[model samples]
Each structure stands twice: as C-alpha cells, then as structure tokens.
Target: MLLQLISHSLGWLSAQVSAKAQDALIAVLSSGPVPQHVAFILDGNRRYARSKNMQIKEGHTDGFYTLRKMLEVCIHMNVRCVTAYTFSIENFKRSPAEVDALMDLAEEKLLELCQKGDILDKYGIKLVVVGHRDMLPERVKAAAEKAEEMTKNNDRAIFNLCMPYTSRDEIATAVQSTIHERLDEDADDTVTADDIEAHLMTSLSGSPPLDILVRTSGVKRLSDYLLWQCSEDTQLQFSSTYWPEFGMWDFVPIILDYQRKVWSKA
Candidate 1:
C-alpha cells in the first residue's frame, strides 16, 4: 500500500510538470505574428464566480478589470482594434438579478471611460459599442452615448463593446440598413455580401474583419458573436483559463502564435 501511494503521488507530480512543459513549448513554438483586430468571446464569468462561491456581480467586476488590462497589452502590441463581446442578446435569459447586475456594471464602466479615465484620457483610445441599444435602459444607453461622444475624435485604438448582440441580430440589422441606404436601387437588384457588411452596426471608421479570435475557459463555440466578421482568413485560439484569470502571459503568447500563423501561410 505504501509503494502504491508513493507511485500515485509521483504520477501526479509528473503530470503537473508535463503540463507546464507543454505550455512552455507552445509559447516557444508559436511566435512573431499579431492580428490587426482581435475579438474575444469573454465567456465563463458566472462559472468562475460560482466556483469561487462569489456573487455574480463579482464576476462582472473582475471581468471588467481583466478586459482593461488586456486592452493595455493590445495597445502595446499596436493592435488597431479590439472587439469584446460584453453582453449578448440571449444573455437576458439569465436570472433578472444577474441581468440587472450586469447592466449596472456595464453602465458604470462606460461612465468611467467617459469620465476621462486613465486609459481613455491618457492613451486617447476611442470607445465604441454596437448591438441593440433600444432594448437597454435609459441610463445604460446614455452612458454608451456619452462614451461614444467623448471618444468620437480619438483615434489611437478602438474599444468595441458588443452589448445585447448576436450574429443573427447583427445580420438582420445590417440587411435593414442596406435597404435603407440603397433605397433608390431596385430591391431585386440582388444585394451582395459586401453591401450587407457595409451596413452592419460595427462603427464607421475602419471596423475591419477580425484576424484572430480567442475564447477562454476551454469552450469552443461562437455563442452567436461575430458571424459575418470572421472570414476564412481568421484564426481562433481557445484556452482553458477563465476570462478573469486571463493575463498578459496568455495574451502575449497567443499574439505571437497568430503572427507566426499569418506569416507561415504567406
């Protein structure tokens, strides 16, 4: 029995060392290329909170700070745009208390950004939000509007916050806009994909297609985010680490892998 127990302990230790070695290998092997616009699903907040026996509100609070730090790395890497899926349209299905908490947190963060926060004022980063705003509360909408107004002139970087969004809704909204924009043309003229893309609510100035998308917590699903934007050229990297737990170490390696992938295929 003693020998067996010792054997099991050794096996566990070996596995842990192997896992670290693999991460290091991934870091070393993947390097040198970064994406122009990187979008993140920002999933697993509730799970993270629950696992730690914390309230759902804490999850959003933690996520907000995590996103801010990621943006700093994005700016350091010279990424032109970073689109984050903040609140999905389907997220309303969650409990009302949780939903309300999210809305409050988001509004507060937006207000902070609009108030000339450290990052926004110092770096001159432009803040933008997309998705169904009409469904949002007045205060939330006002916060978004205020942020947009304050950052309308700044051009250093784009912080696209997707609120109450989904690919289906975005596609439908873009289609409607196309019809409105091209009213003079015959409806039967047959609109192409580009025409539809031109109308999507992603913002006017250079909302280019995302090159690399990463989702955390080991989940491998789009969850109705960024449908039309991710083309064949896009690369996705998934991690088991939760979003709140995600750090620059995770981001730096992923960017390096992206750069290598882009250049290798060229």
Candidate 2:
C-alpha cells in the first residue's frame, strides 16, 4: 500500500510538471510570431522501428500517438491550421503487405478519430483529408468523408491530412483543374498561377501559405513535398528526431529559432 501510494504521488507530480512545461511554452509562443499554418513531413517511422527491432507497422502506430500530442500542442498554441503528410503517392511502391498494413492502419485511425471526434469538437477544429480520395479504399474514403462532414461547421482550427499525396502531383492536378475550368468558359480565358493554387489540395482548408514546415529524421530535402507552398519567408526546420519521438516540447526550440531568425526580421 505504501509503494502504491508513492507511485501515484510520483505520477501526479509528473503530470503537473508536464502541464506546467506546456503552459510555459504556450505563454512564450503567444507573445511572439506564431505560425498560422504549419506542415509536418512525418518521416523516420521505419528507422525508429528498425532501431527497436519492431515491425514497420508498429512504428507507424507509434507515430499516430505523436500526432495526437502534436495536435494538443497546436491547439494550445492557437495555430490556425496544421497539415500532416499522412501518406505519399509514392508509398504505393512499397511491398504489397506493407502497403496493405498502412492502409488498414490509416482506415482504423480515421474511424477512431471519427468515433472520438470530441478532440476536434473541443478545439472547434475542422478535419479535412486532402488528396486523391478516389484512389483510397472504399472504407477509408467513407471514413474520411464522414470525418469531414462531421467537422464541417468547425471554424476555430483546421487539420488537414495529406493522404496519398505528393506535392508534384498536387501541382499537376491543380494546373489541370485550372485549364479545365478555363476550357469550360466559352471565351478565351487566361489562367494565372494564383488560379491554379486556388484549385490545389491545400486550398481546401483555405490555409494560408505554409509559414513553417518541419521534416523529421534529419532529412534536409523537401522530398517532393510542398514545393509550391514554400515561400521565401517560410521557415524550414529539420528535426533529427524520428516521427515517433517528436513531442510537444520539441516544438519550442524550433519555433523560437524561427522567431529569432525569420519572424523578427519580418
């Protein structure tokens, strides 16, 4: 009984410490230039799994927990929009078993989010899946559609899941859409870059130009992600940590560095 009491006491203390740390970060970020729309390239899951001698599927599952934690921090920071690179179109090249596992996990997680969508409700966050939905499994697409429908009325925040997406493909699709729209008009209409962007997958959220993009696993390259959205002032932070290891606290130094180097100058 004494040991049990001590364990409980320690847990309580740890929780308090975590809460205080989060509050401190939020207070500091609130005073500075906070990113309106932040994008994350969720990488390094396989490496993390390899390190632990775990299956690739287990690594992806761990990454989902990190995403939940990230969402909590973003909500606390009052970020207007957050985009996660959930899956890339190139991922279809993986082994069939691996691809199947990933698709199953994605479907499971989406349905779980729908059932427990109070997290979105708590923050009044609109959840939207931006990608080639037609290529997704029927059940996965159905879940995504339901999640979007359920959160359609929300306005405080927007969470975008870029599933089966690639920046190059997105840009190409946008261009095709713009041209198609122009062709629909009887008169010869000029199509501008802005018109193409308006048709982009990212445009669904009405999300502003990506203010900051974080890629984990020490990757410095964009890897065909968000090529068009990256502005001159957009701050890019490459984190050495694996996606499964990313946490709310890890965001502090990155944001602070951006403030010192980019936002302060702006």
Best-fitting candidate, measured by TM-score? 2
Worst 10 residues of 2 by lDDT: 113-122
- Give the distance in Å from residue 156's predicted Cα in candidate 2 to where it truly belongs: 0.6
User: lDDT tens string, model 2, 16-90?
Assistant: 999998899798787887788889999999999999999999999999889878987887887899999999989
C-alpha RMSD for every candidate: 8.1, 1.5
- The whole-model C-alpha lDDT of candidate 2 against the native structure comes to 0.87
Whole-model Cα lDDT per candidate? 0.83, 0.87
The C-alpha TM-scores of every prediction are 0.85, 0.95
Q: Would you give me the overall lDDT of model 1? A: 0.83
* Candidate 1 positional error at 70, Å: 0.2
